[model samples]
Structures are given as structure tokens and as C-alpha cells.
Target chain A: MDSIMRVTVYIKIKPEVLDPQGTAIARALSDLGFAGINKVRQGKIIEIDLDKTNAIKAVSDTESMCERLLANTIIEDYSISIGE
Target chain B: MDSIMRVTVYIKIKPEVLDPQGTAIARALSDLGFAGINKVRQGKIIEIDLDKTNAIKAVSDTESMCERLLANTIIEDYSISIGE
Candidate 1:
């Protein structure tokens, strides 16, 4: 038997940093014919693997991780969703 | 007038590598009472700013940036989203 879980974390800028990457993406989309896609912002999605059963515990733990190490709380905000 | 755009890039694990960070998050969630949250994965979110109106171009440029510099496409995957 295998006891494991998977979760995804989303973290992004707090609307402060300059988004040059986003601008570049938006440009690419236009070249690709993705109309109406005026602006482009990029965020991070982290997938984690763990050995556990309690899902709630996972989210809270991840959130704290985001606050402490994963993300810069002063300039970035993060959200977590767990599953599998 | 600001001829600029914002894009968010989400970079995450490729589901093959073991995520120690995710495991730690799961453990933390259990302590916080976030029931059902079994796993937790952490990722990165990058916000970029650009000077342009053509959104399509922005996306393409950003994608290339991810492929070239912004993200490591080997053990990780990335997605882009656009907005004001």
C-alpha cells in the first residue's frame, strides 16, 4: 500500500514588481492569434508529493511554507490546493 | 498613457521528482485543521511588466522567455495568464 498525496501551490507578485515577462507573454499570444488577451501575468504552480492521509494538514503546512520560504510574503501572495 | 501589460507565469514540478517541501506543507495543514487537504505542492509565480498594446506579442515573448531564461523547462512545467 502506498500512502501519498499531491498538492498545487499558486504564488504571484503583489501588483508591485514590474512584469516584463507578462508583457512578453501577451506579445506571444497575439502572434498566436489569441485575441482579446490584452494582458498577460505569470504565476507559479508548485506540485508537492507527500506521505500522509490528512489533507487539511497539508494545506496549512504548505501555506506556512509559502509564508516562510516558498514565497516572499512582502512582495508575493500565495494560494494552495491539495489533492491526490 | 501607459503602453504596458502584466503577465503571471506559474512554474511547477514535473510530477516525477519527489517533493519534500510538499510533504512538509501537508504536515503543517494537519496541525491547522484544514481537513481533506492531503498533499501540498509549491510553485513559483512571476509578474512581469511591459510596454506594448498588442497582447498577443506579449504572450509569445513571455513563453520564449520562460523557455530561455525565466523557467527551467526540464524538471518543471510553466503556464501563463494575462490581465490588466
Candidate 2:
């Protein structure tokens, strides 16, 4: 039996980095009369389905994946969650 | 004092929607030696900072925003989480 696991990775640009999409979102919200919104930041979520069943190994692999290809560590930060 | 709240929204494509980016990511990962990864899905996260302190209102507003602009309901599903 294959021990399949799902991992969700959330990646966001560093605070200092300029996010044109986020700025555009905020402006659009204001135009839509949702003026209470103070700030908006846009990011990405990557969900990976893995064949590994071991929880610890899955997470470790996912993290390495993030470091190597999933995220740009110089300008973004990411978080990972493992699910059944 | 203004009650500020943070809301995180996760948006993903409908299962039936073709995800080229995800496919590309999976292929890239395979090229990088992470061949155990079976599938991948790519989505977006939008974090909003609201001036409204009430948790309920913050969530409601965020949902409305998602419907209006943050997400394309036609081919996507979104979930919202509120944080301090």
C-alpha cells in the first residue's frame, strides 16, 4: 500500500519586497467601497501529493523541495503543512 | 482604538480545471531529483489587514472581497482564516 501524503506550502514575499499585485488588490478594494481594508499582500500556495507515508520524512522532503525549487528564499518565505 | 484583524484567504482551482503551472512545477521537481512527488497544485493566498476589530465582520468582509475580486468563483474555491 502506498502511504500517500498531502503537503500545503504557503509562500509570501518578504515585507520589504514590492508587491504590485497586492497594491493593485488594495486599490481595487478601495474602489469597491471596502475602505476598511488597510493592507493586502498576495502570496502563493503549492500543494504537493507525495508517495511517502512517513510524516516526518514527508515534511523534510517538502521543505527541501521548497528550498530548492518551490520558493525563492532570497525574497520569499514559506510555511509547510502535512495532511493525510 | 481601532481593532485591527488579519485574514488569510487560500484560493485553489477546481479539480476539473487544468493546472499548467502545477504540472510545470511537478516536472521541475522531478528534474531536481524529487521524483517521489506524485502531484502538485498551485494556488494563491491573499492576506488582508482590516481596521475592523470584530472577528465576525472581518471574516464576512473578507469573504465578500474574495467573491468580488480575490477569487474567480467560476473555476476556483477559496477558504478564509482570521488571525489576530
Candidate 3:
């Protein structure tokens, strides 16, 4: 029998890392007619699958993977979630 | 006059990019007790703001932008959506 887990992580640039995508989006917003959209930032969402007997432990391991390999802690921050 | 539109683009590997993240997730899924989860591929979601008098045109422009700049057409594919 095999088990599966779905992990989604969102990674975004540090505020200081000039976000061209965000800027472009902001400009597009102004063009579209929405006002007061002061700023925008772009990010990435990564979904992973894992096998483990314990759901809690699997999530923890995925978090560690994010911290260790998936994201650069120095310039990026990430959020993680686990599901069936 | 100002306008605003929200655009979301999802980018994924072309199935041959050797997705280590997807591989990791698949392993995690088996560990977490989910059975029959065959394959997983990791991707990114980019949200943008656009300004245009016409919603239809805005969506089209966003799609072109995705093709020209946002995504690598050779190794990636993208989907775009527009909103308020």
C-alpha cells in the first residue's frame, strides 16, 4: 500500500528585491481602472507529493525541505500546507 | 480615468524538465498515507494587475505578455485569467 500527501508552498521575493512583475501588475491595475492599489508582489507556488505514515510528520518534513532546499531563506519566505 | 484588472497565471514544467520538487512531493505523498496518487508536478502562480478600458483586451494582452515574457515557451506552459 502507498500513501500520498500534497504540499503547497508559496515563495515570494523579499521586499527589497525589486519586483518587476509586481510593478508591471501595478501599472496594469492603473490601466484597468482600479485605484488605491498601492503595490504588488509576485510569488511562486510549489506543490509536492510525499509518502509517510504520519500526516503530522510528513508536513514537518516538507517544511524542512522548503527551508533547506526549495527556498532561499536569505532572500525568500515561504508558507506550507499539507493535504490528502 | 483609471482602471484595474487582476490577472493570475499558472506556469508548469513541460513534463520533461526533471521536476525534483514534484518528485519530492510524490515521495511525501506515499509517506503521508495517501494511496494511488500517481504523479505530481510543481508549478507557479503569478498574480498581476492590469489597466485597460476593455476587459477583453486586457485578458488578451496579459496572455501575450505571458507568452513573450512571463513564461519560457520552450520548457513551460502558462494559463492566464482576468478579474476585478
Candidate 4:
């Protein structure tokens, strides 16, 4: 059955790679008088809808999507979550 | 002990709001020959480090950060996850 399924992908920059944007957020929070703040890193979250009911296949396809476009393997790391 | 703790914040656009970036990703995937794609939505993943050992206090402080700056409550919704 070609039913709809949902998959979520979380992408984050590599630890070694500098995250200036995230650093900026940390500074901004500090400027706003927020205390106890240390470091802040930001990433992208993508929720995809696929016309496939099989959970296993959905995850497989999503991994391909990540390897292809969803993430930059050179400087980013990605994790995939499927089903509820 | 003032050890560092990590808290993750997930911010997503309200369902009613349009997400062109997500839409573009879906279309791009289709053009690249990947099929069965229906829809896609994008969000933000913010990982915050705080100099607090208490998990409870960390979440509370992060929530304030969300309400104050991280999210634009008008068109977005955010959730927080703490510790492992």
C-alpha cells in the first residue's frame, strides 16, 4: 500500500568545524543578560513525508537523501528518526 | 559542582505557516530521481550548554532562552530535551 509515512532528520555541524553562527547565539544570549550560558550550537531539522508505508524502506531512502543532499558529509553529521 | 550540562531545543514552524525551504528540498529530491516524496518541513535544533549540574534548573533556564530569543513565538513552537 502506498500510504504516507513520516521521517525526521537532524543535521549538525562537525565538532571540529567552527560554528560561528552558534557562537553568535551564545554571545547574543549573554548580551541579553542570560546567565549560566556556556555554548550554543544550532542545527537543521527536516521532517519528510514519503508515500511509503514500510518503515524500514523509509529510513533507507532517507539515509540516501542525507548522503545526497540533506547533509554535507564533509562538515556535517546527521541522524535519522523514523516512525513515532 | 558547576559542571556543564547539555540541553537541546527543537523549534518548528507552526503547521499553518508555509515553509518554502522545505518545499524546495522535496522538489530537489524529486528532480534528482527520488520518488514517493510527498511533503517536507524544516525546523531548528539548538544545543545549549549551561554551567549547571541540576537538570531541572537547566531546563527552566533554557525555556526562558526560548521564550526570550530562540523562538519567535508568533509563528513557531519549541520543545526542550535535557540530559542524555
**Over 4 Å off, model 2:** none
By lDDT, highest first, what's the ranking? 4, 2, 3, 1
Per-model TM-score, in order, reads 0.55, 0.92, 0.59, 0.94
* Best prediction by DockQ: 4
- Runs in model 4 lying further than 4 Å from the true structure: none
Which scores greater on lDDT, model 1 or model 3? Answer: 3
- Candidate 1: list runs displaced more than 4 Å: A1-84, B31-34
Q: What is the clash tally of candidate 3?
A: 39
lDDT of 3 at A27: 76
Candidate 4, clashing residue pairs? none
lDDT of each: 0.68, 0.89, 0.69, 0.91
Question: Best to worst by TM-score, what's the order?
Answer: 4, 2, 3, 1
Winner by lDDT: 4
- TM-score of each candidate's B chain against the true B chain: 0.81, 0.90, 0.74, 0.90
Q: Rank candidates, DockQ, best first.
A: 4, 2, 1, 3
